[model samples]
Target chain A: MHIGALHISGVNLQEVEQKVLDVAVNIICDEKGKDYLIVDDNPGSEILVLNADSAEGSKILNNASENQVKIVFSSSTQSGKNIITMPTPVRVIALKNVLIKIAEQLYAYIISKKGHLKAVKKPTVLPEAQKIENIFQQLLQIKLANKCSLISSTGLPSIYIDGVNGRFITEKSTDDIEKYLNLDFNSVESKEISYEQLNEYSKNMPVAALNSILWRCALACSNGKLLPGHSENTPVKLTSWPNFSRHGFKPDYFKLAAIMAKQYISLMELNRQTQIPFKEITDFYNAAFAVDIIETVTDKSKLKKTGPIKSSQNKSILKKLAQRLGIN
Target chain B: MLQLNTDKIIFTGPVGAGKTTAISSISDTPPVSTDVNTSGEERKLKDSTTVAMDYSYIEMDDGTKVHLYGTPGQTRFDFMWKILTKGGLGLVLLINNDHPEPVKQMEFYLDSFSDFIDETGVVIGVTRTSINDQANIEDYQAKLFERNQIFPVFEVDSRSEGDIKVLIQALLAILAN
Candidate 1:
């Protein structure tokens, strides 16, 4: 019998890896050896001992000519070793199986952790933000298409906009547009206007005012996406003109949606030098505001769906948002 | 609740005259629709109703809501016509001249909504069959004048939301007066 021992650390003996190795090595030894009959000496290989006192196990160990069973020890808490008893001359199948199983366990852990880390690091913007961005792009397209061409007799002067910087364009071109058209766009003055301009502007201001409101909303909802929870105190990306009680403005979802609608209306009312009808703008805004409650509720619900969307939902969301603004 | 305000003006028109696309061109909520007509014809390879008459509302900054009721153009859904016109301030009757009896169809809608017209008045949105027909809208305007008091009438593309809004606003001015 072979008396050999193997020290396998880094594994709790009760764990699957150590147990598998013990079973495989024991099975290989018993199949080829006779009890107390053989004696061999092999010192190069590690040994696993399940039965320490059997004479057949000692003889097999003494006859281990290939140095296959180097050492053997009991598998008790204090033993701290793998079981190696008999030595088989044919093959070392158990050692190979144990190593393969450990590799598989390690590979599985790495794969699962990699997936978990990815889920934890996804983008956190709200889906609604993409929708708003798209709406902005669509508005830009509309505005660009309807952009005034200054037929200065020399040629149409090209206005280069760095981006959708309305304030930049307006500041740059307000004087020129006012001077060329021979109308005092005096709102550019102290942001000032006379009684007549104010009235006409107010009557038609619904659209432009509304557009500004949506612009604010798109701003407030910066990178907003429909997430799966509601956080009321979370800062809305747009500025809220909620305090304008003289006009009966209450900053709610309807007000927000109303603002967006007003924005779209204002965009359309600016047909080069053509004045859009005030009543038409009013009706369009009125119609959109009429559905304010429905939209707000829907917006609230949608914000709870997931993290924000990618950029693809922008165009469709913009078109939908434009209608909500009652642009026509 | 999310009820459409009762006072908003609605533009009720017939199909194949560009209702949904027109409304959507300007509508904010994709124009809340119940469109069996579009789906039905789409499956059969026939004409589709761009706008199925449904309800949508717009609100003024002063909190006044304008509800637009788009009516399907098909005569089969004419039952919806009456319901749609119940509280309407006016109607934008889209008269498709491509129809064999376009004038007659306009008359049918006008006559069908005669009581509503008597109360709220109506406008004519004439879809010109060909661009060359200079007096086509005027011809319908004349016909409308004979049937009802001269209401606002114009050549319009039902697909354009802005154009439709202009038509409705004209009707609104008439109603206000």
Candidate 2:
């Protein structure tokens, strides 16, 4: 039995089933369809081979001739008695097992999320985007509800997202927001005003000073970490990922938590004051949470602890635990 | 019974120049203001925590309902100026005599609404006679004439409700003519 060109380095047959399962078609060698070639005949399979420089090597050609796999190669070879005319590198065929696995995983994730793989079109609101934003806002609101004793604005629609935990409100009519919510927005007067002159004036002001004001306000209102510069949020760690920090994706949970905490405090503070307009407080809170003033974290962790974590206000509990452990 | 429709007129000027007091004198009801304590930066613009803007409904005897918007003195909210001027028929630019450069303030409003004034006439309202002694309201009136073709300029105390109404009447007359 002559083995033909059996060089496999980068190909992981274990995941091959998964990668090509959806695209791969089963081709039965016999009429009964019982025994299949289990071959990945999909055009997309070409993505597997990143480079074929080594396959053009003379040694590899010799290896193929010895294997007697009836090599019909792509490249012209100088020597080989049994070697058929060559046009390209010897194609290494694999069992259909890996492609099957890829198809299974893809369908499983799609089903789990109730999502169907569709080509993304520009300017269209994707359901997945709304879902992610909803999850983030819910997490922030839940965290803030527990941590802050008071919230400032009443009759205002605002959502807080964790990882940036920033409060975003529609200063414009809730028409756009209602479209996203897929519901009618309650009628409320919009009070947040943007002064073109003032906005431009602030742009001329020192960004560092503005950041300092934002940090100080957030710190004074509640206990939250003032991250270094703007890009210092904790990175998100997903459990199923192949490797940590793969492709440099970081999640900023701390900044998100801090922003929500401040918004909760500011809203509550506004509510406490009878005469102060709630809209102004909302604007201040928004200014503080502006992306330019804060940063996000990029380091991801492997721990997948779900559920509402302890509120930021319950630092005393941690302190007590520290005392019990005799650690300061 | 002559039914008249009143358009929203936003009076924007420096703080202590009495934007709220000016609009309140002519409005049927007290204006809703977002007033708060002056932060360190705002104290320079306002004697106290001056209101950013006051919204009041004005119903003309002719059944014309107009809204009057008064902005706070601090330049901090120049952003809100655009929103207030979005559909404004015209602006009543109030100038305070107490400010060393009342003309400069008028120029600021004009520059802010240069585009708006291009489409609609701006009525200049000068408040506080004491500060106007050096050049008087007439000097500013001349300034307005030089800058605008249809700009209506007047001298009045924004503190008195009736006197401020006179200014609105002047704006109405200019708009009517």
Q: What would the TM-scores of all predictions be?
A: 0.33, 0.32
lDDT of 2 at B99: 79
Which lDDT value does model 1 have at A311? 36
Task: Write model 2 residue lDDT over A174-197, tens digit each, in one string.
Answer: 222333332222222222222222
lDDT (Cα, 0-100) at B10 in candidate 1? 53
Query: Candidate 1, overall lDDT?
Result: 0.39
Question: What overall lDDT goes with each candidate model?
Answer: 0.39, 0.40
TM-score of 2: 0.32
Question: lDDT (0-100) at residue B111 of candidate 2?
Answer: 86
Can you tell me which runs of candidate 1 are displaced by over 4 Å?
A1-328, B1-5, B37-47, B50-52, B128-135
Q: List model 1 lDDT by residue over A61-102, tens digit each.
A: 445444232233222111112222222221123233232222
TM-score attained by chain A of model 1: 0.17
Q: Return the TM-score for chain B, candidate 2.
A: 0.83
Candidate 2 per-residue lDDT, tens place, B94-156, comes to 888777778778878888888876655466767775554444443453344334232445566
Candidate 2 stretches with Cα past 4 Å from truth are A1-328, B1-6, B39-47, B61-64, B145-150
